[model samples]
Target: MLIENMKMAFSAIRINKMRSFLTMLGIIIGIGSVISIVSIGDTMRTMFADLYKEVGLTQAYISIGYWLDDVRQSDYFTLDDLERVKEVFGDEIAYIDSQSYVSADALYGRAKVKFDFQGIDYNYQDVQPVNIIYGRYLNEGDVKGRRKNVVMDVKSALQLFGVENAVGRTFRTTIYGSTDEYTVVGVYKKDLSPFQAMMMGQSDGGSAFIPYTLLTWPNDYFYAMRVYAKDDVNLDDFFGRLKVFIGRLKMRDAEDYYMATAVEEMGMMDSMMGGLSAAVGGIAAISLLVGGIGIMNIMLVSVTERTREIGIRKSLGARTKDIMIQFLTESALLSACGGMIGILLGSGLVSAVGAVLGVTAVVRPSVVLLAVGFSALVGIFFGMYPASKAAKKDPIEALRYE
Candidate 1:
């Protein structure tokens, strides 16, 4: 009986192919928009997760700055402070390294570029390891010997020397007021997160890393310290101890300095992304309501046009419930077909956009199912009035109508 009802519903639709397509238009646009936004949001979330994973979430950062009356005071971390952190954490700490930045201008023959300079200890790579495409990274010998060796990011190397493989090449740069020459010993791949890019000023800016020992500035001062904890250590316990130790050393409140773990940062980002996705999806859903109304209006017109047909069916001993079911099935099939088309359209659009943005578009199976189910519900809700109207028509009255 159900199959027979579907066939009759489909036959009606086939008879008015153009009108049926026009009615389904609204559903197609509504579902397509929502699905496309969802796909893009999921892709962005995945990208952020991958970035956090690449830079270990177990790591923490301590910036050397203090606040007084809501005003921030720039300060620096001393070598003594680093030693105290090590002594306090002991076995709980895996490794610690300090880094500072300076602004300098690099000159290689006629080509010159200005960039932010970074000074790092030998153990810096142990905490934040980057891929080395050419030559070797900084080692204990370079730090102990106070060697003026540097490692440049691939983009920076290309900008400075017109080639990514600029290993063993020397460049002159002015540090403070004195001019010094440094040899590029390695080229490292660059992968900066949005926060890191903003902090570093430019995403593709020319920058180089050198051993802190080579800098003439007081060895006691550093801009920030990165601390990595052992895998088995309890991070909460470690952070609590660190706060107390820093408080005693600074002779002030532990909140004076900014201390945070990568995990905390990632959580904040996740919440923000989730809210954005929900907001976008909600806005797009408004179109579905409009689509439902369109379906209801068209179903009413169909009933009015087929009044004689309904009367004949009733006269032939057809039940009122049967008439209602046929109409309802037609409505559902109309909406379900639109939903299928929208899914295909949305997925294709997402893939095209993802290719342009260099990201892999992600569409979950659950999202697809939800979209189809919601569309079917819309059909039922709107189709109710029209179906009831067709079922209640008196056979004698409908048959007498033109």
Candidate 2:
């Protein structure tokens, strides 16, 4: 009986092919939009997770809140404090360093190019490593001996010396009102993520790296420190205690210090992404309601056009339940077919966008199933009125109609 009803439904749909397609248009668009948004959101989340993994989840940052008016220079963590942290938390810490930057003009021969020098210790790379194309990174000897050697990106090297490999070359720059020449020990390539590249704009000059010991800015006080914990350590707990320990060293309250971990950052980003996706997805879903209304209107027209047919079926001993089920099934099949097509369209969209963004698109099976089920439910809910109206028509009245 169910198979017979489906066949009848298919026959009716085939008879008015164009109208059926027009009616299914709404469902197709609604499901497609929702699927695309969901798949992209999932893809971004996956990309974020991969990025965090590459940066290491055990990494964290600590900074002094100098924005407070009462905050003094003495409140800043010093080189001694940095060493003390290493001494006390030696077992838990994998790498630690103080981060500072200086802006200066690099003078090589007749050329004067702008460059920002990032001051870091030997352990800095272990926490946030970089790609070195030529020469080697900073060593313990460089930091301990206060060597004026530096590592620069390929872009800056070309701008300064007109060459990609500026190793064994020297450029003069002023630091703290004193002029000195610094050698380029290494050259590296700059790497930025797709999202980062979009958000960041061009800078006045490229960036280079130097030993922290050489950057003596107003008594060498640092406002920030970067630390990476051991893989086996719990990042939250370790940072929590480290904050307190630093607070004690500074003779200040723990609340005065600020800490940021990759784990917390990852969670916050995921939440933000999820909320944005939901908000946009909800807006897109309004189209599905419009589609459902379209279905209802077309079903009413179908019933009216087939009144004589309905009457004949009733006269042939067809029950009212049979009439209702037949129309409902037809509506459902229409919506289901539209949903399948929408899925294909959405998959194609994901592939294109993912290729451009360099992220692997993630389309979950559960999401697909939910979209299909909801579309069918929309069909049944909207088809109720038309199906009921058709089933309740008096056989004598329907048979007399044109």
Candidate 3:
């Protein structure tokens, strides 16, 4: 009986194909837009993960205290503190690396790189995910010897030297103090970062990497310390302990200087973004209600136009439930067809946008399935009133309409 009703539904749609298509337009647009917008979020997750991999770094780069505070009111960690941290938490944590940033932004001509020529210890590369594509990374011997070595990215090299092969070249940079010539030993390809204008907003993207003590004459004047933990929970706990350590060092309350954890911040960002996405999706989903209303509007009109036929069916002893089911089936089929088309169009739209934005298009199969299922539900929801009205129409009254 359902199959027979389906065939009749198709024929009815065929007879008024133009109106049926017009009625479906709202549903198609509403569903397609929701699917397409949400798909971008999926690609963003992949992009962030790949970025972490390319930085030649691990996920938890840890350092819980100030690099160096010039003022007598010292609220920072020192080499001794770093040593204490390593000695105490060495087994539980990952490698500890020292870091220093230039006091001012270094300008290689008009292009300014925000990252100071950072000073780092020997195991810096291992802790972080930086790749030395062209040249070698900084070594410990350079730090001990105070060698003036600089490593840079392809874009940074081009900005400063206007060429790709900047390795073995020398330039006088005012990085640490008195202008001194530092040899560019190796050039590297930088990891992808979303904050382009502030390239190293998350990191020092365009800036050069040098030995721990290479940037300055004495290594004691370092700016920041970076610690890369073994893994996720390891670093988290290390930071937890380090906060206690910093409190002791600060000679005051725990909040003297800000302590931040990337993992903590990132997780929070993910959770907040997840809520935001759901909220936006919920608002967008409301459009589906509008589309369903349109479907009901059209379906009710269809039933009214065929009122005489309905009366004839009732005269032939067709049960009210049977008539209601036929109309409901037609309404559902209309929405289902709209949903299928929306899925196709939404996928194409996401792919096209992804290409333009230089990101991958991620289509969730579940999203497709859910979209179609939701469309069927819309049919049932909005079709309720119209179906009931059609079922309640008296056969004698319906026949008089003709």
Q: List the candidates' TM-scores in order.
A: 0.88, 0.90, 0.84
Model 2, 148-224: lDDT tens digits are 99999899899989999999999899987889989989998867767544534336686888998787556778778
lDDT score, residue 297, model 1? Answer: 96
Over 1-402, each residue of candidate 1 has an lDDT whose tens digit, in order, gives: 999988988998899899988998888888888889898888877877777766676788886444455532224566667778888787888777675677787899998887677777677776678889999898878876868899988888989899999999999988766788989999999776554454336644587788865553444466677788887888878877787677678676677778888789888988998999889888778888888899999999999998998999999987989999989988888887788788888989999877766767878899899889888888878888999999999999989879
- What is the total number of backbone clashes in candidate 1? 0
Candidate 2 ranges beyond 4 A from true positions = 1-3, 110-113, 175-178, 190-193, 196-205
Best by lDDT: 2
Give the local distance difference test score of model 2. Answer: 0.86
**Leading candidate by TM-score:** 2
Query: Which of the two candidates, 1 or 3, achieves a greater lDDT against the reference?
Result: 1
* Model 1: how far residue 138 lies from native, Å: 0.8
Winner by lDDT between candidate 2 and candidate 1: 2
Question: Model 1 misses residue 267 by how many Å?
Answer: 1.4
Q: In candidate 1, which residue ranges exceed 4 Å CA deviation?
A: 64-66, 69-75, 144-146, 162-165, 176-178, 190-202, 213-220
Q: Residue-wise lDDT of candidate 3 within 337-372, one digit each (tens)?
A: 888888888899989878876666888998888989
How much RMSD separates candidate 2 from the native structure? 2.5
**TM-score sort, best first:** 2, 1, 3
